[model samples]
Target: MDKKKFPVLIKYCFLKGKNTVKAKTWLDAEFPDTARGKSTIKHSYTKLRCGEMNTEGGEHSGRPKEVVTDENIKKIHKMIATECVHHIIDEYLGMRKLCAKWVPHKLTFDQQ
Candidate 1:
């Protein structure tokens, strides 16, 4: 049921002269829960017919596989530190901003 094995088995069925539907059926019977779809079998069968025998996938272009790098962690930590300091300073001054307007940190009940 390995992902790579699906294509290999599909290729085997192709070499045995089985059509796409038959190949899919055989795979489904062998790997009931993990069989590749008809479209996938057909695609692999097409590739086999075209003489591309390598079953493994080639390198593909897409978004990077990793996003949480050390540099990104450092950047986020620095941003949070600066924002925290700014908030502390504002709190100490008993002042806060609301909708771009300077407002007192503590408001009267009527103001609330």
Candidate 2:
């Protein structure tokens, strides 16, 4: 249910002297098969009863920021260049099979 409607529903229930359970029952009956469940109704009731319910939602802690700036780009580019050149030299010069034991497992899998 929309957060905007919570205040109105809570107000109506308040005026009618209905308990949270009664309000929840009415909401479930009215908005059947909805995303809103018992927990949502109960939470709204708790907020309304505690005088914390507001029109605007509170700020939430979301995913952490992962900014890939110019420094990160240059570092990644250098790593890729080094790895590719090493692999190319080993494979083209026929040194890969002889030195296969020395090569890292990750590099072998990547080459394949």
Candidate 3:
């Protein structure tokens, strides 16, 4: 049921000369709940045919995983505290709304 096993099984089927559909059927029979999709089996078969023998996935430029270490968490907390303090100071000093004007929520045509 492990994901890594799927590619290995698919590769075995390919090497055994089983076509994509047959490989999918075999996998379904073996792993009813966690069988890989037909397209996935076919893709793996194609890759095997193209000389990509590695059953594992290749390196891809995906979004980097967020590491939630204590150090990272502390850094994030420090940044958030600094930002909050800055916001509070700016608001108290009236520095954030210097070019603002008050208006009614529902404006009349003349006001607009």
Better of 1 and 2 by lDDT: 1
Q: Which residue segments of model 2 deviate by more than 4 Å?
A: 1-11, 64-112
Worst-scoring 10-residue span by lDDT in model 1 = 85-94
lDDT of 3 by residue, 1-112 (tens): 7897888888889989999999989889989999999888878877888999997777879766878789999999988876785566565543343337533445579967
Q: Single out the weakest 10-residue window by summed lDDT for candidate 2.
A: 97-106
- Per-prediction count of colliding residue pairs? 0, 0, 0
Candidate 2 colliding pairs: none
lDDT order, best first, reads 1, 3, 2
Clashing pairs in 3: none
Against the true structure, candidate 2 reaches a TM-score of: 0.43
What TM-score against the true fold does each predicted structure earn? 0.56, 0.43, 0.56
Residue 84 lDDT, candidate 1, scale 0-100? 86
RMSD of 2: 9.4
lDDT score, residue 57, model 2? 61
Candidate 1: pairs in clash: none
Query: lDDT per residue, candidate 1, 1-112, as tens digits?
Result: 6797787898899999999988888888999999999888888877888999998888999878897899989999988876785676686777787898777888999989
Per-candidate Cα lDDT values, in order, are 0.85, 0.65, 0.80
What lDDT does model 2 reach?
A: 0.65
Each candidate: RMSD: 7.4, 9.4, 8.3
Candidate 2 lDDT tens digits, 70-110 = 98899999888767856666655444443445443335555
